[model samples]
Target: MASNRPAPEAPYVPNDPDFGGYDEQTWEEWNPTEESVRPVRGRHRVHKKGGGGLARSSTVLGVGVIAAVGAGGIATAQDGKPPVSISLPDLGAVADSLPEAKSLPGVGALISDDSAGSPADAVTAAAPLTAAGVSSADAEQGTTDAGEALRARIMRQAENQQHQADDAVRTAAEEAAVKKAAEEATAQQKAAEQKAEAKAAAKKKKEEEARKAKAEAERLAKLAKSFAIPTSSYTLTSHFGDAGSMWSSGHHTGLDFAAPTGTPLKAVHTGTVKEAGWAGAYGYRTVLELEDGTEIWYCHQSSMNVSAGQKVSTGDVIGRVGATGNVTGPHLHMEVHTSGGANIDPLAWLQGKGLNP
Candidate 1:
């Protein structure tokens, strides 16, 4: 090899140091000329798919599932259904096709979110639609019809209550007035009865007093008539019995009343005249008989004024005094006798009536 070998130009060194005896060296150990260090182009190797791709796919799938569940929850709250994928372009069409929710009475204040579950809830909640300020005209008209009807019902209820209250007040007032009137009437009646009773009692008392006064007057008049004096002015001259030489019956049998020759002789009691004539030794005499059968005789009278059978009352002058019959002077003789002809003393009878004889 040495005789024919030409000079060794370079050694065959492999890129893999372990495959050949070439020493492993850096670029500085294998320094070459600029033309030899030129970069060479070749087919590039593609990288193998790694676990990161799988992890990224899993993350996207998880996010999608979470989004689906969240949509389903909202759908369930609104329409009681699972969520469905919907394109944005289809939303407007579906919303427009949905029917309007029916309104309820006394439910105007209920908000859309307050519903338990309904398809309209989703649409209503999005805008938070409420019945406030919204005209209930359509709903109310469908149910009750006119506005006047509702107003009339409310007014009628109020009027009925007011009428009841007024009736109660009127009844109470009437009862009170009736009670007051009854009480007043009862009081007036009682007062009138008392007044009538008092008047009756006074009338009876006055009648009794008048009766007693009349009886007393009559009694006094009868007493005066029984024992009246025979003359207003006279003097006692001769005793009832005198024993003297000038005597007719040996003793005076009657009392003597002396006065002027023409003194009046009055009746002693109410009587009728029995005699008014002259008699022997008893000139100008008058006799009177009372209702009790007693007799009064006036003797020795100057004159007689009463005739026979004439009615005379007490104090009637029946004769005049004179010196006649057996009298010694101008005097009148007066005698009283019982029905049996028994003579009684006139002076003693007059003294019994509290009168001077």
Candidate 2:
């Protein structure tokens, strides 16, 4: 029957070298069947039970004995100490009273399910007994090892990710450099092409200008053949810009062609006679306007051959040379004006038109 009374405590003895040695006389030499042996009264004895509640207690107690023996054996070997006998708990009465294994995050996860008997369960076994005996330090070291392994794995993963990121960045930079180089090369090539084109264009234009000048010289040479000098066999008395008081502007303004009276004067170029009469110091004068609006003045003329508005070709007789316009001697005073009425050196002008005079 079940009873509220507590189970009797089992007796255990510890081996001590300081004490008297074990009693070998009380061992197999003691004959319990002899009269000399007697049972002690009121002493509780442990009996093996094959059935009922006592059987459950005996099985639990057996497991506790096996655990203690295994642990003690290991502890005794490492410490070189004598064996220690331990009393087992009353599992039948307080089986649930024992504490449960901890369930902390990593710690709980490491606890292998012994019922499964898997290969991984082997790793969850207890640590070897130390001379100091089994302690929480060994378990903590196991936990720390597990944590360190996890930490190492995470660090490696992070490092790999960093390497991948670095590689990607490097790749991007290289690609950008290649692209920039390609663009720069393209720009340089385009600039070179443009420069070459400009150089070729400038060269072509210069050559064309030279060819036109040559062609113009050829045409002007043929035209010069049709031209003639005004009043040939005349003496060159004075040139344009001779510094003398004989002129009004402190310089001679026209060329003086000294000749006999009534010398036939001719037009220098093909033009229309714009003026057949003139006044003042010039006795008789004529003004011829060329097609390009340049004016040629025939001054100090004794007589005029062409009237106003008369068309005349080069070398056509238009007037006569005479000493008429405040002249020191008989001569024709000829002058030239540009289209804008600017008087330039007539010798240079005639040379430009393919004439020697």
Best of the candidates, lDDT: 2
The whole-model lDDT of each prediction reads 0.62, 0.65
| lDDT tens readout by residue for model 1, 154-273 | 687899999999999999999999999999999999999999999998998888888887776676556765667887578877776677667667877777787888888888888999
Candidate whose TM-score is highest: 2
> What's the C-alpha lDDT at position 152 in model 2?
59
- lDDT computed for candidate 1: 0.62
RMSD of each: 26.3, 15.7
lDDT of 2 by residue, 5-123 (tens): 22222222244343344222211111112122121112112222334233223343444445565546544433344555544333333323333222122232344443435443343
